[model samples]
Target: MSAATSPPVSPSAVTSAGRLAWLDALRGIGALAVVAEHMLPWFVPSLRPYWFSLGVYGILVFFLVSGYIIPASLERHGDVRAFWISRFFRLYPLYLVVIAVVLALSWWVPVREAVVRDGSAVAAHATMLLDVVGIGGVADTMWTLSYEMVFYLVVTALYLTRGHERSGTWAIVFAVAAVLVGLVASGAVFGGGWPAYVSCAVFVLGLTGVLVGRLRTFSACALGVMAVACLLLSSRVPWLGTAVLAVMFAGTAIYRWERGTGPLWPVAVTGALVVIAPVWAIESGWWWVQADVWLTTILLAAATFAGGMALRGRRLPRILVWFGLISYSLYLVHHPLLRYFVRVSGDLRGEPLAYQLVMTAAALVVIIAVSAVTYRFVEKPMQDLGRRISRRCRGGPQGGGEVRVPGESTGDDRVLRHEERQVPHRVSDDVDQGESVG
Candidate 1:
């Protein structure tokens, strides 16, 4: 590695909070791909084959990125309280705003409101795991958040139990278990009335156990297993959901190995499982049967991740990096914006494809503009506040931070107490924090 790209080898090294710029570019690409995946179908009906939805490709990329980063974030903070607090601030603010916007818009456009079944809407909205607990999302795109939450919780559990180093092994185990469980019982493990409530209750208890139980290690391990079970059984799309998570953990394993924290074999094993498990599920009559598209998407996701890692040292364009900075905002805002646009404009039928393309282009412009505003006004400020609170809660000096993994920095730490007083107009270190898209 070049000196500039090399990870820090000592405590005194000046680690940075800057992300690899190319990864940000990838985030931007993934966000826009999702936008196209949803928007294109409305415009181009011909593209709607069971072959591949760009949406799946985009989300899988996001899952991989999340797996890579979230664990690193937790380990860096080394304080579960701070990590949770930071995560809450990082995700919830924009999420709430988008939900509020969508809810407000639903007054005029009834379709904007998601299906509410048996008063489960509130719980689903509150937890963002609507699909997992046998409920629907307020927004269709929000279902992915449920899996992301489970990943975070399970990650936290592993961390607490000091078993995080075995993430790859666990990932493989989950994938294999998903395959085994799919054979006989491929539905919700817990059935009967209020299954959502029961799942939520178990999640809460498991979360509490890991966070504060006297036997936290055992609690964490048990909770991790239960969480995997929930993923494979209770989620609306069990096989796909389980695979998404396994892919994410594979990303995590890749990151760990990249950072010299683990060996390549575990990542290799996880990658093998990642490829084999989903295919097995499909072939065994447990999941979707679109092997051609699904397999291609999986390979594409793997290639994209590998490409990002290979290109980590190269400089990426400013606009792409900026798009990455605002990607979360884009991801959250696009669906609502599209819904409102479509509601107001009505169907664009009978118009030329070019005209629809123009409209889509206009929508993209609007989404980006709104996302820029939200990132600046909401995401960035909340992140700063979260950092301050986290630092306070950790009882550290106000301006200081530490890097985990003593020999290498993950580029998530900020340097404080610089002698130079002048701040640059554009902060080069305005790295996007979270990997979860929505």
Candidate 2:
């Protein structure tokens, strides 16, 4: 928090708490939102207004979480190669497996036209480009990933170069300028235009402060201000996506300054408002009320972040952590899955409504089964494997809370279990071998 602290390793900060569990709970919450959003039509008319559109907020939470975590992972390893190797193992394999399964399901399932059309726009989604020029667009609540991957790549690069402190500032300026230019060029910045580029830039631009050896007061204040401003104006901001992206960037800044003191009350207050500005727009009576919403959102994110810090050492259920671990994959695949089930259920026609209900249950089971499979068989194992490989190749601590580019500890996180073992078994002979393969 002050100096170059280590990465945050516990699912949360508290040693007594199940840090990972909290994250899993958040992810599970998000996943449910996605499922309910997709199942809108199946529910009775009175209940079908897409109650879970708020899941998009959950996706934004994921991005904020990523902004907090990815840099920590990279900082732990102290090398770009190892950082990338870890990322490859962490995301790609599971993503490929999930996407492949979704693609396969199209044949047997009766997906909706819009669902499939939207899904198709994101052929590059697994690559994390939901904002791209539409091989497939961000149809399945997956648009957040483009920023996640971009953040991973850029933050790792910056941290490794030890220029995170300096470059972060410049990146933000440039990225914002890009958004403004796109606006000037087209006379509109939203609607998939230049602002989207800026929205995409949030992830990349955030890397600047990620490598910070210490969190700063001013930066925190500035981030809090900008995020609130973005929210207050969300209605005018085209798709509201830019504000989502800004929060991701702002979240990183807030974390950079929070410095593990647990969240400061003031920062936490502002954070909350920023996270929920969109709600203010929908619920408030006047445009000025929306401005108040901005402050409220800023208050929310800062407070929750602080809350996350305070809750760090508290104990939570293991089941919760397990769910948190596979959240990203679940988030990515849930929409298509729900759509596929709807398609298949429609064909059954026993009772159109009845089939929808039965298949909805089936869809839940399938998502859980698939996420469990991915976590056990793919995500965790590969993460362990990749960390081992990275440690062996780089010859440094491999399983700490944060990857230290300087190969030292700032104490942000504990060493993961396997990381604590001297020379994990897989790393000894496999580092070079894995490097080559990677």
TM-score of each: 0.82, 0.62
lDDT of 1 by residue, 1-438 (tens): 344564543121122322355556777778877888877766555555556558887888888778877786666556665666677787889888877876676667663334564555665566566666666665667778888887877887777766777777877876766555545445576543365665566656655654443555566566566666667667665766776777778877877777666666765666555555554357565332456666777777778878876665555677866777787888888887887787766786556888887887888888889989999999889888886776676675421222244433434343312301221112222222235654
lDDT of the structure predicted as candidate 1? 0.65
Tens digits of per-residue lDDT for model 2, 1-438: 443465444332223334333444444555555556555545323354332233443454565555555454444444555555566676677667766776666577533343235433343443454443222332355445554554444444445446554322423432353344324332222233333333334423332233232332233233333333222232133224344444454555544554442333423433443434344344534332254444443344344445555654566555645555566556666666666665655543335666556666777789778766766777667877877776665654423224354433545323443333433232211212111101
Q: Against the unseen true structure, what C-alpha lDDT does each candidate score? A: 0.65, 0.45
Model 2 poorest 10 in a row by lDDT: 429-438
N/CA/C clash count, model 2: 56
Top-TM-score structure, candidate number: 1
Whole-model lDDT for model 2 versus the true structure?
Answer: 0.45
Residue range with the least summed lDDT across 10 consecutive positions in model 1: 419-428
